[model samples]
Target: MQPIPAKLAALAQQENLHFLLAVESGSRAWGFASPDSDYDVRALYIRPSAHYLAIDEGKDTFEFIEDEWFDVGAWDIRKALRLLRKSNAVLLEWLRSPVVYAADSAFVRDLNTLAPQYAQAAPLLHHYRGIARNALGAMDLHGEIRLKKWFYVLRPLLAARWAVQRGGIPPMTLAELMADLPPAAVAEIRDLVALKSGQAENYRHRLSASLIALTKTLAAEVAALTAPAPPAPATAPLDALFRTTLQRVYPC
Candidate 1:
């Protein structure tokens, strides 16, 4: 681990937050980082057993930004497990991210084993649809658009399509989604990505008509599809894992 990851780990421990999983979760993880991309570190942590026994529930999330380049946030294990059972797409992506900073081996192993069992198309599709819709809605006026925003919209649109057609989470990277895109759209997007790669953040470009049309059509199609029923995950297993983790991290 580099200094950034090491510092993040130390900060978590200093707060008595035992991190079970930590990984990259944004543009960098998605394989389209620009020259000035920020580090978006997402992690899952657990408090001491005593903290869990408190009369009042405390904050379930922690956020720290040491500088413009380093932004780290985490969810407590209890909150994470609850969200996982509900097929929260963000948590699903966290588990799927390829860049791991620090992780408890057994905890990650168990989480991966449980990920597929709880995978559901409906909530995930709904989630992606919302993401795509927001990104599209936020587009700048008169064909001018942030190149990165195109990816923000396109990825979720593709993810929604993947959920509906393939019945699972989509690949985490934009390059992986190219095969399913129209030839023109893919080419345009790749060029925009290359352009963005050489530039700093806040880069914008005139939207190609073809790319705009492709995004609008895909968004419409994804929005029209019926969301499938979420899978009924077995609660006992998740419950057991939660207890086991608490015990392991705060043994007497």
Candidate 2:
């Protein structure tokens, strides 16, 4: 479980990937996992200088999948930021994950310094809203409420709350986000999680009508978060973060 980061780092280097940033971002990062949950590993890497000289852009990203057992991918910073600006929550999860296996310590340390500069509320709100809607729909339609669907709904809502509190991107883990909510809210989340424990993989659980109602309210909360437009047409920060971080961390 723990050595994955090192293995990923080694993979990147051996493949001549200009590895920059790496961290735990999936079930392991989230804290509570089904005994059978797959390890989801994600990272960002770049190409060598020669590859950059070519006419074609390097592969935009890399993907490796192993059934439902493991998934590891690397995104070009551009791809990442586009998703981030569109409210990609996974990126936030990586930034906030407590279980760090590997990191360009200084690279992450520096990125942390700049996180707030680009942490706008509007994009994140829109992102969370969409995410909650999708999860809530599953809960509403499934009749048998999926034990996992609630977490999907809960994670985004907590993320929205975190974004609101910090005026920056929020961590995605249920536990980390709880600290930003009221004590009562924290208790509520814990109870719900415990109630759903046997459900990690069941994908079917019953949500009380009250639970459905709460999920709806989360949608409204997502709507409340909105961002001001950038001064000019601009790219999502994911690219710059990737390029600079990679160059900085993996010097030629």
Query: What is the TM-score of each predicted model, taking all chains together?
Result: 0.92, 0.79
lDDT of 2 by residue, 67-182 (tens): 67767778865566566554455666677777665666765765566555556666676677677777776556437665666677777786775676566677667887778556
lDDT of 2: 0.65
Clashing pairs in 1: none
lDDT of 1 by residue, 1-252 (tens): 257668876887689888899899999988778999989999999888888888999889999888888888999988998998998899999988889888999899998888877878899898999999898888753577777887889889988888878876677888886777778777778888788899877887787667767877898899897765875777898899999988888885
Task: Mark the regions of model 2 whose C-alpha exceeds 4 Å error after superposition.
Answer: 77-89, 180-185, 195-200, 208-210, 230-252
Local distance difference test values of all predictions, in order? 0.84, 0.65
Question: Among all windows of ten consecutive residues in candidate 1, which has the lowest summed lDDT?
Answer: 139-148
Off by over 4 Å in 1: 140-142
**Ten-residue segment with the worst summed lDDT in candidate 2?**
229-238
How big is the positional error of residue 234 in model 2, measured in Å on the Cα after superposition? 8.2
Residue 243 displacement (Å), model 2: 7.0
